[model samples]
Target chain A: MNTWNVAKLVAAKDLRIEARSRVITNQVLPFAAIAMVMFAFALDNENDALLVQVAPGLIWLATLFSLLILVQRSFAIETADGAIDALRVAGIDPGGIFLGKAAALAAQLVALETILIGAAVLLYHTEIRLGGVVLLVTTVLAATCGLAFVGTLYGGLAAGIKGRETLLPLLLLPVVAPVLIGATRALEAAFGTGKAVLADGWPWLGLLITFAAAFGVVGVLAFGPLLDE
Target chain B: METIVDLRDVVAVLGQFPALAGASLTVLRGEIVLLQGPNGAGKTSLLRVCAGLLPVVRGHAVVLGHDLTVDRSGVRAKVGLLGHTNGLYPELSVRDNVQFWGTTVGASSGEIDAALDRLGLSLRLADVQVGRLSAGQKRRTALACLVARRAVLWLLDEPHAGLDAEGRDELDAVLRQAAASGATVLVASHELERAGALAHRTVQVIAGQVHEVEQ
Candidate 1:
């Protein structure tokens, strides 16, 4: 296999492993969904403007939490059977492994985001207009990219950390905050929701892209060192 | 006569810990070199550096004419590794696991099947999920990946620890065949007597340092 081919193989392997385990479904996704649903319920009666104002952060935060918690499952595949060492010894590119894992994580986060969006509409009684859809999808993808990139590294590092169950969140949040900030701001732009032109979004989207790109490059370069560690 | 593998006084340090130090080793085309060492002897670390999987703080390593420090991506394509973990997709059936790794290593389906045939796994365990396989079978399946890969260098780490007699023989034949076919083999094994049968030369390592042991 070539570059993307190896990535696909690695990602598909991760997905298959995730399917077999159900850890993502049982632990991370459900808790995140419940958290989102509860937040929407808790604030259902508050001032509409206030809820809208915070909605961007709340939604992105929930999604980011879920991605951070769940995406570690992708890394678990390697740490479980010592597959990371095997892959490294196989002379496989750590970059390919990272991208493959990030890809798998992106797929899982997209699914979870769709579930949350549905929950927001039906259970939470949140509304989505034309521009709302654009903003939501953009926020979901951009945030997912940033979290997936950062999470993969920490998840691998956490494999060695003492209190990984508790420490993973602490290790991940600070590194990923910039991406989170840019994404939250971009989603906040959807507040008034009349026209919300793409030009208005161009900068935030650009920032999001830069964060994702930087995370990708930096994550790839740095993960090798962490793995070697 | 080409040197498919070369290493020159390789010193690799991980922070304060020394992983491999003053490690000079080589594997010419079709040579089978058995690497035996106790735990923490840098056996895995040495193989990893050779495969370009680990960073070497000093010294140079080249595999198939690709430098470990510089042209790692190029060298990686020409090497196959079967470590203690030995690349297995537990969720996938034996066939699928083989096929997926084949894709990553750029081996064709026919080559994978032939590899399985060489390992005697082509018929019995084809459809079984890899997770269900026993330890020896997992090791065999990993070796199957090596057969399928047909790379220039085969890095086998602790490949024969849990195998039965037949399994051990099978792995021995696999290594011998790979070496005979002009693929340099660097195996780090705990099974010394068994390895003595197949290895052309044996090199010992201790606590991240190399020692010459002719047995």
Candidate 2:
């Protein structure tokens, strides 16, 4: 009945399952790193300036694709054995379930993004300036929250449907376009990729905050009905 | 006797298919009622409706003093529905699965242990992942979870399907014990000979309508 308590329980359950399964470490993370490598090779150049200029968008792009895999894996666990129905019948607050799932996803995304950022610096010769560190952290956190909330909401929407594997990306990609654009632009400003300043990136952070807040509220309200349907 | 379930002309649909076409049934407290019907005769739908998992499109329905048509969610915590799937997380251990469901109702660790023990999951077996267990063991684990929830209403669909002879007898005993403790049970089972012996009454569901079997 207590929403916070339920959220904690559900989040812990999901994290524990993930820890035991090792799927992210064994599969998804490597896939993301490999995607970064593939992106570097696709440009077909040893020119460090070009790779550095494009690294921000490339990192976020890898994160987005990895997010699709994470969301699918998250819901797959629930639908595999009707555990979602059991959760509904158990009378756990759906809002709490939404928060819990989103939180776990945000945590995973943070880890994935951290690795991807490091990959960018290593592979693309991108510079992380001392002045931009604060804005970069803020951008990653806010963007992760927005992506997690939207991913959980859309994942629940597409759950239990036949061919949801194909449907989820179609439904999710359009909704997340703003996030991709916002995060990339913010990161570009933070990295000073083109002639941008840290002040310019702060405004994009505002957009990311609003996006996260808006989707967070909508996910909590709509998740229950979506699960029921 | 107190009425635990009351339905009149309840109509429920699954994407345009009227799964419960104006079906009516009444069940009292502490009664074990068997629902007999062929496949797709609305038996599962009826149980789902009682468990508050299905919406009543038209008609009046109430379970545990909660008017389902008004608010079906209120009855969910007090009822347990065991459908075809065991609803167990394959990656979780037996104890973890039972504990997770049990904690929803605030059941303590001791109660979880007792439920696992009641279902013959020893300490060794309780530590094993449910995915590795046999079909019969998974069913038992599911039953253990239901017991741990301390549900007032039991909605079991083909509960005895995957059990061996001994497991089947054990399941029947568990149901009888639950009934003795004043819990109402509605079981949709094809094994009439076994379930009929355990039920106090039997009702036939034909074409989404209920007919008394006159036990």
Candidate 3:
């Protein structure tokens, strides 16, 4: 019917499928948890000061890797049974489909971030502060949106190709460099020992929001043509 | 006659190869036409072109009153294509898969059940995941989805490939019923004798060109 309603339907389908399969929770979650632990080992767990210093960058890196998996799985699920063809001809607007996919991916990212952040705090012994919580949430949301937008676009771009697993990160990493940097810097400003980068995380948050808006709009507009054979 | 599909010298390229090299065909409303050809003869490509999945880079191609050159998305909602892949989610139940397609086209819940029942998928199998079902059952589930959409144009590619005798008979009845209900049907199959039984006319596709086959 309506665009928003259609998007909800698509998102609901993906979430329902994920809930049944538990691929992300059972497989990817453990992989990210182990990755975070490895990062701690890499930084030398005895040195809490250095661990805190690099936790922000490691968190973003873990999220990026997890995102690559999530995006690839999202497209792979559709590749089965020629579902992509069904989707193209199903009468739903391509933009609606793109929004639905991006939303589902964003939801998965939220889960991954929560788990990875929890691991980072416990393993890395990072300090927690109640201040700047709003900015932290804003930064995460903006960055998530940006990643999901580009992920969905490139995921669609790489569908049906044999080398998509290797191709997606190649297509996505360069475009998403700004997101990783902006998000990490914002987190560092919020949680790092260097408390005087700027008054607030506003500047980095602004960068994240701009990236989100630009890529989000582009993804919606380009999804139809990208999926067309 | 209301022509649902009209392709004139349409060219579709897949990588460096031209799948539809100057192919042309027309299908009217409520007609069941069989498309027969060898492997790589472009039967699948022609069906794809009709469904607006393949872009026509040259000449004229139209479906459901929308020009493919201008925008193919306009015709997608009104067309249902059942390709080689069943297009069902392996993790999702039969009912869920059917509902996904149904909801995509805005079909009512009642209509969804009726479509499933028409394809002989009982209530028991409806809740079972598609991955657990046999190939025939999966095909039936996909056919249920196509029926649920109630689309005006139906493009079936090798629809009877995996089905047993009973399932084949059921599909034949479904095709006849669909045409009787005024939906255009185009089926591509290598099973010439069986496919011919369901067609009012047959068209041969050779190297992406369409020619009428004498009955």
Candidate 4:
């Protein structure tokens, strides 16, 4: 079977399910938004300058937490009715399945990140410079891809295992440390926090790109074995 | 008759437990073989092994001309296995679930529609989410997906469990039609009287071993 076609089909199926279920929009999104608000409230007693300085890190921290929930939700669908086994038996390419799931996850994370960034702008009074728009967009895309790839990979690893709900974060958090740090740093630069220049963020974007590419390759090759296990 | 499945002393493991210990069975094309065994007798493991979902640890096994020991994934596309769960997405409509699985095998829209009709899933029912359907209806939907797949080998485990009398009759008819079209079927079921009537041969699975009954 053509991997591209299978990827498209799987991605479309997942997105369609998400659209119908409304779990991401109704539950995960609100949870993420609430978490962001909580972060802002935690810093309410602190000075406004401190909140502005830390807005990027706080936004990404919320995104990372939400990533865990999104990953759990994505794999839950496959294991809920033993649909993963059906997919395996159908002989759809494992790499295609991995890519399809990751793409869908990336799409969802993009939406989540967009809202979180908006919330940060309003809650933390962070300013966006014209020169940083390209950098910020690039950082979001790259970091989202990195997180999605890792999430899908680890989610597949934890799928079908007893206690996977708890196991997923354990297996996932350390692996994504680089993404959290790299994305936060890049965003800090893009947002002109800590007096960092846009040029400084480009190097961080390189790390994000490499992380995404590495996991993308590894996820495609490893997903089959993980799914079987 | 061409051999559709050949397993000689197949040994399969689930974790540390030997799910299939020295099991041997052979099935020919266009034949329906019933696998009857008590719980934990390795019946599902055997079907999974044949479908390429389970590994053959130490055995010579081939299904649909693919050496499973060499490449278990190769035969997967040509075989359909229906396990305990219906394998239908609960959130997706009956038609969407059927269409998704059917699309994997390159089944056309016409084929999907025909499969739905064959399973007695009316257009109105087809539009309903599988989660909302009755147990028998969900089974029918999963069967519709298998029908649309046009698999050369069918591996069904307790396929009649949740099905009603009419649904069971429909399943029997679908299996017969598939076998007549040269598809091999290996069904593990407890409903011996019902399954035995539809099977061309009956094999007993006792403690992960196969013993053919003189039918």
Question: What TM-score fits each model?
Answer: 0.85, 0.98, 0.96, 0.98
What tens-digit string does per-residue lDDT give for candidate 2 at B109-213? 999999998889966899999999999999999999999999999999999998999999999999999999999999999999999999999999988888889
Global lDDT of model 3 = 0.88
lDDT of 2 by residue, A1-229 (tens): 5888888888888888889887789989999999999999987475677888889999999999999999999998899888888888987789999999999999999999999999999999889999999999999999999999999999999997999999999999999999998999899989999788889898899999999999999999999999898
What tens-digit string does per-residue lDDT give for candidate 1 at A154-204? Answer: 787886556777888888888877876777666656443334444565588
Among all windows of ten consecutive residues in candidate 2 chain A, which has the lowest summed lDDT? A42-51
Higher-lDDT candidate among 1 and 2? Answer: 2
Candidate 1 positional error at B207, Å: 5.2
Residue-level error in angstroms, candidate 4, position B6: 0.8
Worst 10 residues of 1 chain B by lDDT: B69-78
Residue-wise C-alpha lDDT for candidate 3, range A89-146, written one tens digit per residue: 8878788889999999999998888777788789888765677677667778999999
B92-122: candidate 1 lDDT, tens digit per residue = 7777777766766677788988988999898
Give the winner by DockQ: 4
- Model 2: residue B81 alpha-carbon error in angstroms: 0.7
Each candidate's interface RMSD (Å, one decimal) is: 2.5, 0.8, 0.9, 0.8
Residue B207, model 2: Cα distance from true site in angstroms: 0.6
| Native contacts kept, each candidate | 0.53, 0.65, 0.91, 0.81
